[model samples]
Target: MYDHTKQYRCTIIRGKSKKEMDDFLPVYAKVIDEICPCSESEFESLFNNAFIRFLPESDRIKKTMDNHRTEIAGKLFGMYYRADDGIVYESERTQKFLEDNDQPAFFKDICYKMQFPNGTQKVGTTVRQRVADGICIRPIAFVLKVLLIAKQANVFITKREIGYYILNSLDVLQGNASPYEVFEQIVKDQKDGTERTIIVPGKATSYNWQHIKEQLNYLELANLIRFTDDKRVVLNLNELQTIELFAADYDKKPEFDVYSYDLSSLDGRKVFQLDWDYYFSQISAVSDQFATSAEALLFDGTVKDEQKSEGKPKPAVNLTAFGDEGESIVYEYEKKRVSEFNTRLANKVLSLGRTKGIGYDIQSVIAEPGDMAEFVKYIEVKSTKRLTCPDMNDDLWVDTLNVTRNEWIAAQQHGKFYSIFRVYFTRDGIFMFVIANVAEKLNDGRMTAVPMTYRVDFNKSSVDSVIVPQS
Candidate 1:
């Protein structure tokens, strides 16, 4: 419900405004004066260096500045003239100058502004000011606040715990109503399009807890946090401080204090119970979206298997009857399917099961029409039995399906040419899902890559198939 587009517009306008320059220039000048008195050109050089250091390494600030020098100069002049002369600003002259010359630096747009219910706007002094003031609607900042709370508590927290904490404390932190009272007002504003007011004690609308849980997933994808073996959310201590600083939009050390909590005394179960039924009801509304057998297998409680309870008898064919041999059936099926898809390249499809070091289970070729060329494709097939119950020991439900180090390395090396075939055996039939270029997805955080195996030191040649220690 947060208006991100409006927030972005506010940021850009604030960054490009005269007020921002006026606020920044004096502080910059004082810093330079403390070091050594310098000419305007020297001051500009020093300030530019200092500013660039605060920005992400990937930014194109220098190139943008060089390409738009004339427009930037004109805009600066217009701002300064209007402020010093105490006259109404003339936009036509500046617009004409900007149109005739190159545009201002692209980096100038990164700022923040806040709009109140009244027809008034508050401009941010810096690009990060909006984020620091908690006016920005970015999930990263909210997630960082969760981590900060966890850090202060010195304990790993769960997603449910974080959501409850935010629901209870965010309004209080912002100097609004108490946690119980705030959502009622928020819901009223959302429903009637009228400004919210103090409400008489009555039934309140339910809050969306899943939205907060999804934010935790975003943080995990960013590598700022990791799920422990016990499924608790653990902050990556090494990245925590750096992430906090970046989230706060701090150019150097933060000027403001981050919120902390005494979570040790807080009962997460009690807090979570207040809206548990409502949260599950919200989840149930979206249950139909996950129709795949794999999703059903992963979350047995929420995602019901379509094959079952439809009066369809279970298939007599047991996919996992022969263990690794059953997976061979899937590999054969994949090869046949690929061959059928491209009859011309069928002869080029080679089963790599006998080859141990190749990593992939199959290698196939796709014929390119109008050219005497063939594209090589590597496929890794993984077959699993129908999971009727959830695995209690695994942090992630999908961890039951394991990939060796060699297979992962091969996927990384082949990238686009590589694919993972996950075959799920259901009561109806074997359902196959293709994850093409899985390595690329994993690297980009689109897919999660959780480590599963641990190595033990051993001399392979020194031991026989069955090792018997001397008694």
Candidate 2:
């Protein structure tokens, strides 16, 4: 999705304020559901009137009964599945947004393509036009990743540094290219060879260094970042406590090397459906970790979350972080449970996630209060971050889980001693469900397993090697 050789510029889509969007998008979707196959003008009229009803009794609103169809679609066109015949339809993302009704999910979709090389807005085009392209590189994700990395290294980064070099180049944004290293090169181009405001123009790299910063200003709604007195960009840890959520250790690996696809020919909804399902799967508000509070999301310049999730605060995150966190959460849970019975067994609770070929993540033992330990149990942790907490709400929910070939084999070999701890991350907290004796369950028709992925091999021995004279 990222071209290392190409340079990309940031695009801004400030078609509406945060609250306007929070109010309008859902209403737009509702109108569509209420009347499908509606004309563009019809949608515009209904959506405008419906949304206007939600506003307060203000003179400004009363004075100007605006037609915001163009403005609304400018920023959020990617969420629409419209027809060339001027009709609109319900999209998968629209359904997901309605399914998980909130400002965070709404803004989450927005942020996924808020930055450069985005689909919702044009990139490197004459018309850096809002709602023009069909590509979503998520430079914000890359930018966030860079900031998180620099934070760990105690590196103070300025907005210009991020905008000029990092966001401008796909190499730094999507490849292993370092922002500091690229900045160092930029310094070489400078007459001062360091930070300065010396005038230098006519060169391709010397003008408009703060282009992306304009778009960065729009991220105030998310409220995930702050600027220092020196204009350095920093995570808003002091106010939001979002530092832990963006921890560098959470997702240690980089996602630079991913399969590439072009959807410029497709519509916004189709592009979003594919990207939402695959590209931004774990990175968006769909994951509890990535989700911000309602206040941060729907920021009117000031607000914080009133209702925080209870229990150990394990925020849903990327897949790697999700697994690591799930294992740790289960490990702690096991330790605490065992400590109630036998402190010694609790101390012995082991995290085997790093241990190779274990086919499991954690290890514990079944025991009674009086050190009545029965046998050791191998735990395989399967984790997923969802829109809702089935445990918290007592709602019956089940998702198809992919079990590795090694894990299935371990479940079979370990018999009754094996347990699968299913951990689900919601905005509330992580909920775990234990399924013990998986082999027996599968044998007795209680459960079934299917092959998800496999490695294919040819029987070379059967097809004997040709022994021909050397050419």
Q: Which candidate comes out best when scored by TM-score? A: 2
Q: After superposition, how far is residue 423 of candidate 1 from its true place, in Å?
A: 0.2
lDDT of 1 at 333: 68
Residues 313-379, candidate 1: write the lDDT tens digits: 2322221232344346656765676667676667777777667877788787644454533778788
Q: List candidate 1 segments past 4 Å from native.
A: 1-342, 367-373, 387-400, 456-471
Q: How accurate locally is residue 62 in candidate 2, as Cα lDDT from 0 to 100?
A: 28
Native-to-model Cα distance after best TM-score fit, residue 234 in candidate 1, in Å: 46
Candidate 1: residue 223 Cα off by (Å): 39
Model 2: lDDT of residue 376: 81
Whole-model alpha-carbon lDDT for candidate 2: 0.52
lDDT of 2 at 286: 32
